[model samples]
Target chain A: MVEEKEQIRIGIAEGAILATPGTLMTAGLGSCVGLVIYDDSRLLAGMVHIMLPESPHGRPSHPQKYADTGIAWLYETLMEHGASHAHLRAKYAGGSQMFQALQMEALRIGERNVRAVSMQLERLRIPVLGADVGGNVGRTVWFELPSRHYLIRTARGDERQM
Target chain B: MRRLQVDPVTLDALREFGNIGAGHAATALSTLLGGRVKMSVTDARLCPFSEIVDVVGGGETIVAAVFIRIFGTISGNMFVLMSLPSADRLLERLLERLLPAPRKAQEYTELEQSAIAEVGNILSGAYVAAISDLCGISLNQSIPAVAIDMAAALLDIGLMMSGDEENQAILISTSLVHDGNNIDAYFFLLPDLDGTEVLLDILRGKIRHG
Candidate 1:
C-alpha cells in the first residue's frame, strides 16, 4: 500500500493542477466555487478557487478569480499537461448563499457563480459529474487524484463525498 | 495591476478616521456587554485582496462573523470576526438577557446567532456613523448578514465587494479587547477602489484645510 500524505492547498483567486499522488485541497469556499477538473486515466487533477461569475468591468490581474476566465484557463492548462479534454470530468462544490437577509440580486453571488461555472463547463462540452451547492453554509473541499474522488466538509461539520 | 496611491498624508488621515470609528464601535459594544471595551486601529492601508485571508489567521480558521454591505458614498463591506471560543463568551454574556435559560450549547442556537448579528449591526452602525460625519458622505448599510464559518470564506465576501482583483482596497483593521479577556476580534472595513480614491481625495482636502 502506498502512503499518500502530501496535499496541495490553494488560496482564494488561485488554481493548482497537480499530477502528484497526494490530494488537492482548497478551504473556505463560501460564495466561491471549487471547480475541479480531473482526468481519471492520467491521474491529473486541477482545482480553481473561483470567486466571481465573470469579469464584468475588465480582465482581472488574477485570471483564476473569475469563473469565466478561470475555467477556460484551467481547461487549457490541463490540456497542455497531457490530459485530453475528452477524458476530463468536472466536479464542483461550494457557492452557498451564506447571507440570507441581503436580497439584492447582485449580492446573490453564490447562485450566479454556480450558474457561471456550469455554463462554462457546458461551453467546453464537459460533463459535470457531481456538485454540492446552494445553502447558507461554507465548505472546504479535498480532491484525491489517484481515486478521482472529492470530499466536501462543511462549516457545520457535515461531510459529503462526490 | 493598478497601484492604489495612498500617500502618508492619506494614511494618517485614514488612521484618524479609523480611530474615531473604532472608538464609537467600542463604546457601542461595551454598552451591550455591560463591560469595558477597548479598540485600537492597528493599520490602515491599501492592500492586495489575496492577503485578506491571512489577516485573521490562516484561511481555514473557524470563526463567527457578521457581514454588512455598505451602499452609498462609502460603498464597501464591513465585518466583525472572532474565534468560536470568543464568540461563545460573547453569547454567554448576551444570552443572559436574551434567553430565559441562558444555557451554552455546543452549537449556537437561533437566538444566540441573532444576538451575535445584533452586536455586529450595532458596531457597524457606529463605525459608519462616524465615517459619514468625518467624510461628509451619505452612506447606507445593507441588512446585516451573519455566519459562522471559515475565516477565508468570510474574507472572500469582503473581497467580492471590491469587484476587480487587480485593484487595491482600503483595509482598516482594528484590535478589540473586552473586560481584559483579549477577545480575538477583528473589525475589517474594506472599501472598493473607486470609493477608496474618493476617500483619499476627501482626506487630502481635509488635511489641506485643517
Candidate 2:
C-alpha cells in the first residue's frame, strides 16, 4: 500500500514551495495566474498565484500578488532552497477572461497578467514547458513534485495534464 | 489610496442601505416570478480581499454569478450569486420546464444563460434605483455579464476594480428567498474605497439635516 502525499493549498496572492513526496495546488484562478517552477532532478518545486501584472510604486506589502515581483521572489527563494538555477523549468495555468462583454483595456487584466509572467520568465532565462492561458473561463491547477505532473482543471470540469 | 476609516455609524448606515436595496430587489424579483420573495441582509462589513471567496462557500465552489459595473456618483461592482441547485431551480421557473441536472456550468444552454442574465439585470436595476433615491445621487449600470464558474473566479473582477492597494472591502451581503421553491440567491455590493467615502458623506449629511 502506498501513502498519499501531503497537499499544500495556495490561496490568492500567495506562494508555496514543496520538495519530494508533496503536492502544491491552487484553486479557482480566474484572472489570476498560477505559475510553477521546478527542478525535476532535485524534486523541488515552487508555485505562486499572482493577481496583477505589475506592482505600482516599485514594491508593495505583498509582492506575491504581482507577476514581476512574484516571479523574482519565487526564483530567489527556490535557488536559496538548493534548487539549481540552470535546471529550473516552468509551467503555468489560469489567466482567463471571466467577463467577455466589458472590452475595456483596463479590464483585460487576465491577458496582461499572462504577458507579464511570460516576459519575466524569459528575462530570467527559465524555459516555459507548458501553459494554459487566455480564455473566458476559470481554472484550478495542481503540481506533484515527485512525479512532476502538472494538472489543469477548467471550470467546465475538463482536466488535462501539462 | 489611504484606507477609509469605517466607523460604527458608517457600518450601520451601510447595513441600512443594503436592507433597503435588497427589499426593493426582492419586490422586483417577486413581480417578475409572480411569487412571494423574501430578502434578508445577511452581513455587511469590511472583509479582506483574500476571504471574499469564503463568503460564498469557498474558492472552488461552483456558482452562477452576474456582474454589473456601477458608474457615476458612486462606482464599484455588484454581483448576484447562486448555488448550482438554486440556479437550476430559478432556471426551471424562468424557462417553465424541468431540466436534467447539469454536471458543470458549460452545460447551460444559451437561452438559460440569457435568462439568468436578465434576472440579474432586473434585480440590480431595482436595487440601484432604491439606493439612488435614498442618497439623492445619480448612478448608472453597465449591461450585466453572466458567468457560471467557481465563485472566486467570478469575484476576481470585483477585487480588480476595487484597486490593488486596498486589501479590504465593504461587503453588503444579502440573500433572497423564493417562497414555495426553496431558491436561495446571494447579492454582494463591493464599492471602492473612494466610492464608500462619498456614499458615507452623503448619508452623514442626510442624517445631520434630518
Candidate 3:
C-alpha cells in the first residue's frame, strides 16, 4: 500500500519547498506569478507566489513577494536543500492581465512581473523549461515533485500540463 | 502614507461609509431595473488580502465581476460581483428574455457583458458619488471592465493596484437583492493604504468638528 504524500498550499505572496513525493500548489494567481524551481534528478523543488516585479527598497521584509528577490530566495533555498545548481530548471504560470480594457501603466504589473521573474531566473542561470503566462485570465498552478508534473488550470476551465 | 490601524470608532465610521454608499447604489440599481432593489452592508472591515475572496465565498467561486479603478483625490479598486446564477438572472431582467439554463461553464455574450459593465458603472458611480459628497473630495472612475471567473482571480487586481506593502485592505462589502427575484450581488470597496489614511483623516476631521 502506498501512503499519500503531503499537499502544501502556498498562499498569495508566500512559497514552499518540497522534496520527493509531495505537491506544492498555489491558487488564484491573477497578476501574481507562481514559480517552481526544481532539481528533477533529486526530486527537490521550491515554489513561490511572487506578487510584484521588484521590491520598493533594496531589501524587502517579505522577500517572496517580489519577483527579483523571490526568485533568488527560492534558488538559494533550493541549493541549500541539497539541490544541485547545475540541474536546476524552472516552470511558471500566471501573471495575467485580468482586465484587458485597462491600458494604464500600473495595470501592466502582470507583464512586469513576468519580465522580472525571467530576468532573475536568467541571472541565476536557471533555464526555464516551461511557462504558461500572459493573458486576461487567472491560473492555479501545482508542482508535483518526483514526477515533475507541473499543471496549470485557468479560470476559463482549461487545464494543461506545463 | 501610514498603514491604517482600525480602532472601534474607525470601524464604525467605515461601516457607515459603506452604508451610505450602498444606499445610493441600491437606489441607482432600483432606478435602472425599475424595481425595488434592497441592499445591505454585510461586512465592512479591514480584511487581509488572502481572506478577501473568502468574504464573498471562496477563491474558487465562479463569479461575474465588473471592475473599475477609482482615481483622483484617492485611488482604489471597486468590484461588483455576482454568482453565475445571479448574473444570469440579472441579465435576463435587463434583456427582457429568458436565458438558457445555466451551463456548466457559462459564457456571457458581448451585449450581456456590456449590460453587466453598465450596471457596475452606475452602481460604483453612485457609491463613489455618495462618498465624495460626504468627504467633499473629487473622485473619478475609469471605464468599467467585466470578467466571469473565479472570485480570487478577479479580486487580486484590487491588491495588485494597492501595491505589495499592504497585506490588508479596507473592504466594504454590500449585498444587493432584487425584489421578487433571486438576484443577489456583492459590491467590494478596496482602498489602498494611502487612500485609507486620507479617507480616515477626512472622516476623523468631520467627527471632531461635529
Candidate 1 chain B, run of 10 with poorest lDDT:
B97-106
- The DockQ-derived docking category for candidate 2 is medium
Q: How accurate is candidate 2 locally (lDDT)?
A: 0.83
Candidate lDDT values, in order: 0.80, 0.83, 0.82
Candidate 3 local lDDT, B97-127, one digit each (tens): 9988674434678898889899888878877
**Residue-wise C-alpha lDDT for candidate 2, range B1-210, written one tens digit per residue:** 456677877777767777777788888888888788887888777666667788779988999888888888788888888888988988888777998986578898878888888888877787688678678888899998888999988888788778753656556666667756766666666777566667777865665564
lDDT of 1 by residue, A96-121 (tens): 77766678776689999999999999
Q: Worst ten-residue run, lDDT, model 2 chain A?
A: A99-108
Docking class of 3: medium
- Among these predictions, the greatest lDDT belongs to 2
Q: Rank candidates, lDDT, best first.
A: 2, 3, 1
* lDDT for residue A104 in candidate 3, whole number 0-100: 85
Candidate 2 Cα misplacement greater than 4 A, ranges: A1-4, B1-8, B177-179, B204-209
Q: Is candidate 1 or candidate 2 better by TM-score?
A: 2
Error of 1 at A36 (Å): 1.2
What lDDT does model 1 reach?
A: 0.80
Give the range where candidate 3 chain B is weakest over 10 consecutive residues by summed lDDT.
B164-173
Query: TM-score per candidate, in order?
Result: 0.88, 0.91, 0.92
